[model samples]
Target: MDSGIITILLPLALAIIMVGLGLELTPRDFSRVGKHPKAVLIALFCQLVLLVGIAFVICKVLALPPLLAVGLMLLAASPGGSTANLFSYLFKGDIALNISLTAINSVIAAFTLPLIVNFSIQYFMNDGQQISLQFSKILQVFSIIIVPVCMGMLIRHFAPHLTEKLNKPLRIFAVLFLILIIVGAIIKESHQIMSYITQVGLATVIFCICSLMIGYFVPRLLGINSAQARACAFEIGIHNSTLAMTIALTVMANSAVAMPAAIYSIFMYVFAAIFGTLLNRFSRDDVSSRTTSPT
Candidate 1:
């Protein structure tokens, strides 16, 4: 809630979490994109294009306040969270594809996120409210994202054993930090929390369901295999809310602009688990039907 924490501690925490993400990554993750170009490209299109459109629609239809609308767009612009790999592994998705998507998406988001958020601010904040992500702020976003990731990659490349030792602890810290940021954002907006939720809750829930469905079904319809489709599902479904919130609180310096991400974080894991379970059930039924069919 404190400005000191927002400006200083929040970014430091995000850098550590991203560094942990980098430790999990390698040159292989980025290079692997070439091997599964279809899956990667499809996921990115769904994320960067379709989902952003969906969020904009939700914002307009719901008539969200300007800050909240921009927040939703910011969440939409975020890349897949590192946790998507874990979800993919649990749900029988292709983990390698998940990693590749995360790797590629992270790089792309550094450039696109600023552009998207800037557009949202300009378009939605037409109430004479002056909130703009200028060129310098864009560079800050780039450094906040890419620099730590590169640092972690270098550490892993040079001292893999050390990277291994740090990985689990850092992951645990990432989860805890995510929880803390959500709570902090909520508390900072405590007085308006219910009003904000009433305004943004349905939009976020609908957006989450649409995200998971679009992420999975579009890839499936496009001839991607089930395993790869599941990977696409989670990768596109689980956004890096911490990044959105950090940028909101620190970069834009608006707690209201952080609200959508904070609320969406609460719904994502629950919906993702339910969606993964349904996918597994369908996979099992398909296998049963195949095994029982005349051979």
Candidate 2:
């Protein structure tokens, strides 16, 4: 596929996803974070903190190239994405909370992602040359994730009967198609993907694990329950890699920078499934103990 085609494909798919997100949400969903500041703050802090910490370690200790490191940081900075709502629903998490967190986080990321990315480029880009940060790029990202999302929500708000009818199949299609995009990306880059898999692969796996851990414990350490912990784990830890890849291929125009998200895109679903299953098992144990203990 042409780089331009690859560029166009992901963003178009993401716009569809965002529109669905908005259709399912209301303005109240966007504001729910304020209603529960703890969950909101926990999700936001984990995302920002982990991006900086891991990007720093990857850049400084591992001495990875700047674009790759910045790519990883961008992955961290991106929000939970449309898929998380599915994951949250399947895992019996607070869907309302998940939707709210994703909405607020995606908006905040519009500003924060560029700042973190440019700083990482400054420190790690190897040649010490400035990384590009154009206003047009920011607008494109906003269009890709936010604008369509709001449009969807508007449709839902005005024509909720239709939205209610369409919501389920649209969500299903979005999930399945996004999976295909991930597969296509890997298949298209089969040879190079295999070659880069080991180096980028290991880091991607570690990042997912670390992200899950932080999303869960960081909240619980502050006293969030297991259910909310499960919610936070997926929401904070799972990033919108499609958006990250959009940035890399479109804005950054470097496949190496796109590699982290490609690698992560593969790993996150596997680990998220494993993590959700494990959390479910633990939750069952808690239920059993509580029933026996009369709480």
Candidate 3:
């Protein structure tokens, strides 16, 4: 909540988290996108374009307050993270596809996120607040995201033994840091927490559901297999709340702008689990139907 924390510790924390993300990644992750072109392209479209559009529609339809609207847009712009891969593994999704999507999305988001957030700020908050993501700030966003990731990749490339040893610990640390940021955001807006949730809860919930459905069904409609469809569902559904919140608190210097992400963080896992379970149920039924068919 303090300026010191926002300016100093927030970037440091985000850098550590991004580095942890990188430690799990390698060039193979990026190159794998080429192997699953349909799945990857569909997932990216859902993430970078469709999701942002959905958020904008929700913001307009719900008539969200300026700061909160911008926050929702920020959340929409954030890409999936490691947690998506975990969900994919648990729910019969294509974990490899999830990883490739995440790896590529993270790189693309370093550019797209700034564009979306700046547009949100100008459109949503222009009447009163004057927030601008100028070239310098965009460069800062790029550095904050890409630099640490590159550093971590280099570390893993040069020191395989050390990278292996530190991988789990770094992930643990990143999760802990996310929890702290969410809690801090809640505390900073303690009195307004309930009201904020009341304002944004339904919008986020609908957005999450739509995200999962779009991620899954769109790919399936395009003839992507079930496993890859599942991967797309989770990849598009579970956003990197930590990245969104970090950019809000540090880059935008507004905790109000972090509210949607913090609240969405609480709800996304629950929603994703339910969605995954339902998908598995239908998948089992489909398999049984096929197995029971006449030979």
Candidate 4:
């Protein structure tokens, strides 16, 4: 595959996903904060603080290559975008809240992602390898995260019906892009994935579980409702590994660096969905059950 394909595919995929995200939301979607501030903050806290800490530990424990390690860190910072909304709908969560979180996370990540990713590169860069940090990487994030999202928002603002019509097909395209990336990664790194499967797979699974835990429990502890807690759980567990892998393979052009994210992209969905289903099962409507949430 051409580096150009990866370059174009990476940003175009993100923009499509972001636009899909915006199409689902309205201005009133963001108004949930004044109505429900604590829940939102708790969810954001899980995303910003706990997920990053969890990824840092995973990278350190596994002693993954520095590029791969930073790639994991990038995953931590990148939260639910297009995927979260679908999961929210599937799991009967509050979709409006999920969209709001997605929109907000995308905006915050514009700055936060660059900082975390650049630092992770420095922190985890292996001794033998030399990688350059470029300002264009920041621009890439903006192009992917900001530009299409704004376009979608504008469409929503003016022509909501068109936005609605485009929504389904765009989502389908996002899924196809993800599948292609996953397949490409697998084909390119077959032996590397097989050799490092135990280490990286364990890290991905553990991190996914940890994210689900922190996402759900943290919000409940903050006195959020079970539905809101459910939203956070899915959002936290589901990372934007596509962005991380893009940074690794397309921008950084490091196959080893891209592996963690590529592997994580596979693992998180399985583990997170099961975790969400389990949460759906065990959770009770009783206020007491969720209010305490077993710490």
Lowest summed lDDT over 10 consecutive residues: which window, candidate 4? 125-134
lDDT of 1 by residue, 1-295 (tens): 8878989999999999999999989999999988889988899999999999999999999999999999999999999999999999999999999988988988999999999999999899985276779899999999999999989999999999999899999999999999999999998889999999999999999999999999999999999999999999999999999999999999989899999999999999999999999999988999999999998
Against the hidden reference, what TM-scores do the models get? 0.98, 0.89, 0.96, 0.90
RMSD of each: 1.0, 2.5, 1.3, 3.7
Alpha-carbon lDDT, every model? 0.94, 0.76, 0.90, 0.76
Better by TM-score, candidate 4 or 3: 3
lDDT tens per residue, model 4, 32-136: 667777777888888888888888988888786666676678778776756876777778777767877877787788888878777787777764256655798
Stretches off by above 4 angstroms in model 4 are 126-129, 284-295
- The local lDDT score (0 to 100) that residue 56 gets in candidate 4 is 95
Worst 10 residues of 2 by lDDT: 125-134
Q: Highest lDDT: give the candidate number.
A: 1
lDDT winner between candidates 2 and 3: 3
Q: Give, for candidate 3, the lowest lDDT window spanning 10 residues.
A: 125-134
> Model 3 Cα displacement at 218 (Å)?
0.6
Residue 149 shift from truth in candidate 4, angstroms: 0.6
State each candidate's clash count.
0, 2, 0, 1
- Which residue pairs in model 2 clash with each other? 22-153, 23-152
lDDT by residue for model 2 (1-295), tens: 4776667776787777778878877889877777778877877788788655875676566655566777787787777877777788888777778888888887888788887777777766765354565678777766777798888988997898989887888788776766776666667667777756755677778888988888888888998766677778888777888778777767776666777887888789889989888888988998799889954
